[model samples]
Target: MLGEPAAMTENTGDTPRTLRLRADDNVAIVVNAFGLPAGTVFADGLTLLEFVPQGHKVALVDIPQGGTVVRYGEVVGIALRPLPRGSWVEESSVETPVAPDLDALEKATRVPAPLPPLDGYTFEGYRNPDGSVGTKNILAISISVQCVAGTLDVAIRRIKQELLPRYPNVDDVVGLTHAYGCGVAINAPEAVIPIRTLQSLARNPNFGGEVMVVGLGCEKLVSERLLPAGDVAADTGVVRLQDERHAGFGMMLDSIMTMAEARLEVLNRRTRETCPAADLVVGLQCGGSDAFSGVTANPALGHAADLLVRCGATVLFSEVTEVRDAIHLLTPRAASPEIADALIREMAWYDDYLAKGGADRRANPSPGNKKGGLNNIVEKALGSVAKSGTSAITGVLAPGERVRDKGLIFAATPASDFVCGTLQLASGITLQVFSTGRGTPYGLAHAPVIKVATRTELAERWSDLIDLDAGRIATGHATIEEMGEELFRLILDVASGHKQPWSDRWGLFNDLTLFNPAPIT
Candidate 1:
């Protein structure tokens, strides 16, 4: 139903077109690029009493003050005052509704039936000694503290300029630098989040298990702690700037480069081999969203996510606040009671976390979102959940945790694009499908990001940046299934090195920002 065109009425060339999502809905969104002016009439004979912007909602029926305003067949908000038919329904005119009660949610009552297996889908990937596969063969240098970031950057520049050519197979070298590791309460119970994030990032399948760490000698988070469990030791791939052997900045650069070249040599020997689709880990996220996000791009992504699950690939849908208001819809689709409880636990944890910060879930639908027709977080949440594709949620991962289970997993994270992308990297997503309605240039250094546009205007405007255009679904030019199949083939092609996404081609990667909730002291 999501990918299908909304209920459309016949319209002459001069008449405006609008989309009503459900028969029971009282509002419909304007589909024209530029909104229809007041007094314009639809083919249904519904005249606009006031001007409505594109993607903005208009009341299809009269309602009294405090009446429910519905969209997607759900109560998104309440009318603040009397609204006449065909009147523009803007954000200020709607009052946010209370969130669903998490405690009363049904668990595993409506789990989706297993989709028929989609087999024989495979990709060319680097096979690591740890038995994991990699989409890109890169040597990542981890850091124990922020102090060594500058030094590491210098060394990485030299490695790229002087050493990368010798090892043609190694994709790139990255410095896994972050603001954590020092000047914080490292021993705090909450500190495990960032610590584990760094650890998990080093273990990301794309890194090829050739972990290298750079540390300043006296940091609170020592270099050894950043290493994998059984591999921690002084002699194991660590370069300490304060070591007696490093007498000056030049020596420090040499030490890192020496260690880097060794790892690069090992990585250069790796080659892409055939791997099952099950080895693929994909992350689903949406940003710069508008109302069209729910109706177009997100639903198409959801279809692709469902396809990936049927193919035995691991898929992750994240952003706790984005999913908070729609938790009721998700809980019942959990694979089991334990997983359902895990979903609730992560929600409750984030709720408490937000409360402690004197914030609530309503602190969303940014100014850009308002202009793009998102009235509030509740409406945004309903649309945001579409990326999960009705798959039974099989597991949950807290912020910064590594993903362990297969199938669909909810990787909890803050909604900020950089933060969510970083945590998803930590969760082991080899490829990410990012949907944008208002549009963004967001990308990640560690993984390939496929940008999908929700509107045809955006796709045409940013043709070089957007990898796929779901906007055609809104115009009735493409169906959700067709877009899903297109996206799925694109994913395999990109994963197998047969294609490169715009993000990777242009190197438009954003910095990784860790979600550190512990004290600064």
Candidate 2:
């Protein structure tokens, strides 16, 4: 079932809508665009005692002072004062609850029954020599310093215009550029984060192991430092701009183009072969969230995520602050005690990081999130973590680290859309599923972003932008499982190059934003 109806029927005066997630929950999110007026009635016979803005919470039952307000079958906040039934529960009406202590968390207490194997699913993918598979046949050029980005972009455009057509097999050329290589304290302990991010990103599966690097020779980060040792192919692909052999910018372009062609030759010879679903590395995320996000889109995506796990694929769930509020609920679902410990470690590290900056998890739930009816981070997080589904978290990766294990892995990253997407790419995600209620034109150059809308109205309005619609689940037009299956099939098609997501079709790509926690000077 798709839960209770979200909108008022014709009999009710207006379409004053509300969405209740769980039976025990006392709050329901408003569904209509304009705030419903007092006396508005919902399908469930719940009358609005006061105006409730769209996407904000409405009290379904009386909440006494300090009483818990539940959502998602969990306590999201404590009522600061008495709240009568039908009252709007704004952020000021409730206080965020204390975070669950890390040491006392339950471990492996709610392991879900193994889902039936989704067998026989395959995608045509470029197989790499290292046993990894690539969804795109692109020749990617890595840059060792920010100073080289301008030169590299010019070179890439020239290559794409003059050289790419000759290599019919290669999809496109992309420069792996970022703001990290120079003018920073290179040896700072925190500097390792960006270094590793750049290093790992150079090896993303989409690159097909044909990695080339453009460098300003004297930069703190050398091309050799970004590529692994004994990787003769990658080492040979490095083109140093400041090398004596490059007399000027024109000569530098010559060297880069020469190196790029060599990699293109290797990438061109590669062909797509049928690969099992296990070869997929998918990243799950949510932004511009609203009440319907968890009720429809996120849960639907979670179901799809579970299906991917059943197919033995790797799925990554990230955004540190987004999940911090639900840490207590997640640690127990860890695959093992060690994995549970890892989850806590990442959470604790992020907590300390926030404290040092004189902030806390509450700083999340951006202005757009609030406008979409999420009163605070607690409520937003309760919905955000749903993208992970019910699968046991098999592993945890720190910010910018590479993924090593399969199943649902938590890759720690900031909630910023660009930063999260970039770090996920570094962690080897070949495809990304981003659920949005308020909507954004977020895209990445490194991977195809499959945008999903949480509401029907938004979907109909942004038809050309959104790839999938989980809103049907809320409107009773589709079940979460049906949407999930549809998404699963779409993932395979996109990964196989049989379909191009809207982001890719329009060539919409956001810049690669590196997460640099250390000092820049």
Candidate 3:
């Protein structure tokens, strides 16, 4: 009766956790932590007519035929008829009707729609040679091939310790080592040639003027060897990976120091200016989401995203599957018929991917989200979409497309945070505003990731990880507006070369550029 408290506990199986929705209702809502069959009966005085999977709802009390199902202390939907005492609630689920699926009638409720003005707001950001800004002046070491990447990484580690006693502004000297960059035909030139080695490491706005890159001179990708005379070659050091095994490594270290010394002298020239919000491209993301996400953190960020859009900044929000269940909310937001069609195409792709994996997002989710009370993808997407903050859908993006227009952008990704982060960075995102309801250490490589926490306990416990506390909305200490503004300032600091909540203290700067998509085939 202790572990098997189906008679007492809200869900059956593991730990002693139970929940009651109504005071007047009888019989307990039994959550089966384990998958017991339709006819399985527990020793704790409870029997199961059908199994209730984890993160799905169950009956807290017996319901008469046609009775209402209450959740969040409100009538979510009507029970699809009668249920026996102490039986798991199945088939019946919460479904709110909508007129349009992507850009539709979501404002039927009394809550006001987002209508922030587009005036007097801007982020003073730089547009580089490749149309990106260098938020921080970084000195980096990149290897065009993985074979000699170890030598470069080993040398960089030693150099960090060697220079730590001198260069305080030298944020981090890291190695951008990856599996690709070679083994492909370099002679075959196309419209968008393979510049994987140069772009992610060199063009990444975080790195300043001078840098070092070592290459194997003979790999199939020998573009690092082909150079426009006197420009990139004048400052770059490209040594053959096969160099006498020892002279190459020594020359690389010497080149790094030479570049570092030159970059240090110009650190004084960095300045912050008031650039228009049009220059800013904010990326919207949510991880470790919970039941309270739509009610709190996600919507708060959505408002902030709307503010940026109103000020002329383009906001890019990813994770298509997370929003698949909330298709009804996006119906009215789509600006035209084509955008709605594109949105539907991406959703169908996500469903196909899920089917290939043999799992539905509703039936399976990350364990952390389940622990935080999320039911399914529908509920998750409904709450997740709230982060867009009600801005009009000016544009939508494919997996790695750069967001060219301002407004709310529904971008697609593979749902891996690290991979998604890389794709967004490569797609030209200047910064990423990530909100986590439960808790997460996820961040993007090469771009600034501002983490907002949704719970007060998580905020206090892991203050170092959380930059903004949306949890105050949950506890009544701060309004969403206050938190939204706070997050905005944090974004400005990050764009102005200020340290992130953790990076300022720990001196950690990430330069991860992962491209998971097939190479433009």
Candidate 4:
């Protein structure tokens, strides 16, 4: 028999190396640097029956075949065979539970209690012509086809070296490049996904609605389709590389440079003005996840998400497959029956999408995810959902659609970290909070990503890289509430440009990947 749950102590170089989440859980995760060998006794008198790797599960009590294996107060899996006490619970020993049927899910059954309004929080942001607010003032150059990327890159480098210094208010020049725009079925019904993605990304709030387009002039995706209402101004809004008026390649580059300078002149006049927190649009995501993800970092970030919702800000949580196993857990939190239906639509669409590829949710929980102790998609989904906090889902966005309301929204996207981040950026997130238990150096060019660590070990190992250490909560040094409050303040400060996250400081950024479900010909 196991003893009662006791308060965990701080790391004093000789502390216990296990973590039990709940009193009823049948297993605990190994927290030691190297796992303990067989016969190692925990304080509760439970002895290890075998050598378990770090972050792997240790069975707490004897489990009969087909018995439930509980963790985080829910059944994560079922034992495939008799699991004796102290046995290592690897993926092979447990079987994933069947995903809940969409038709059986309840609607608005677990609505979150409205939190008291958070007042007076404000940030200095660039206000856009479309009424959206931007955390950074950047001049984005949109390209219609992949062919113009090389040319655009050269122009961007020159802009950064020469014109950028001239317009001090402009942050940096970004080429909105992608693999789409030609050599595909552009008019196919499914092609709308990537088409809208490029269109909306061009109008990202951080660009301040000052649009510019570069086209190869022969691509299927024309400049008119890429820009909004074909609204590019005559002076400097467009440059066509194939136009005959250009004498040579040098003229083409010079034409791009001239158009860029005109946009810079317009963007340089903009300044940051005080805006209420309600104007904020935040993207929430996770990568390189581990078991501690739910226990510390994600929960704390969820709390901050709830706080942001209370203050009337828009918070978007995405990654379709990451949430597929936990669809039942979210539908009840939907703000209305219509919202619940929208959630189901996104999930069902993804399921069909996967079936066409002859794949399923098992494709998730990457190797790093398994090394971080997530045995299957069921286990990963439970931890990933913690980032959403306890908020009613007020809206849902199809891939690449722009966000129009303020509240907790669900933006449906693939589980790939890069693709998810790109869709979120296109949906208009000004800043992002990314939690990790296994480490990643992931960053976005269009937004500031605040990397959060789930364990003290990773935080200490990569101190300069991590922005916040919610790992303190796991060590008993900080409560979830305290860590959440700190994160909320950090969001405001970072959005105000008063603080720069490591991703921003070191200029580490990943390219924008469009989610093109359409086929290539």
Clash counts for the predictions, in order: 0, 1, 21, 0
Tens-digit lDDT track of model 4 for 1-521: 01212334245565656777777888888777666789887777878889988778888889999999988767889999999999999988999988889999999988888989999999999998878999998989999999999999988898899889999999988989999899999998889889888888988889988788899889898887766785755344678888888888889889998888888888998899999999999999999998778778888888899899999999999999989888888999999999999999999999999999999788688888888789989888888888888889999999999999789999999988999999999999999999999889999878899999998889989888899998887777787778888999999999999999999999999999999988898
User: 2 or 3: which has the higher lDDT?
Assistant: 2
- Candidate 2, 65-173: lDDT as tens digits: 9999988888888999999999999888898887778778887777666778888999999899888888888888888899989998899999999899999999899
lDDT of 1 by residue, 1-521 (tens): 23345586544453587878878889999988888899988877789998899999999999779999998888988999998999999999999999988889999999999989899999999888977788998899999999999989989999999999999999999989999888999999889999989999999999999998999999999999988888778766899999999889999999899889888889989999999998999999999999999888898899999999999999999999999998989999999999999999999999998899999689778998989999999999988999999788999999888988889999999999999999999999999999999999999879899999999999999999999999888787788889988999999999898999999999999988999989999
Per-model TM values vs. the true structure:
0.98, 0.96, 0.70, 0.96
lDDT of each: 0.90, 0.86, 0.59, 0.87
- Where in model 1 is the C-alpha error above 4 Å? 1-6, 10-15
Error of 1 at 115 (Å): 0.8
Give the residue spans of candidate 3 off by over 4 A: 1-118, 122-132, 140-142, 158-171, 182-202, 208-213, 218-240, 243-248, 255-269, 353-364, 497-499, 508-521
- Using lDDT as the yardstick, the better of models 1 and 2 is 1
lDDT of 2 at 101: 82
Q: What TM-score quantifies how close candidate 1 is to the native fold?
A: 0.98
Pairwise TM-score winner, candidates 3 and 4: 4
lDDT of 3 at 343: 76
On TM-score, the candidate that comes out on top is 1
TM-score of 2: 0.96
In candidate 4, stretches whose alpha carbon ends up further than 4 angstroms from where it belongs are 1-12, 230-236
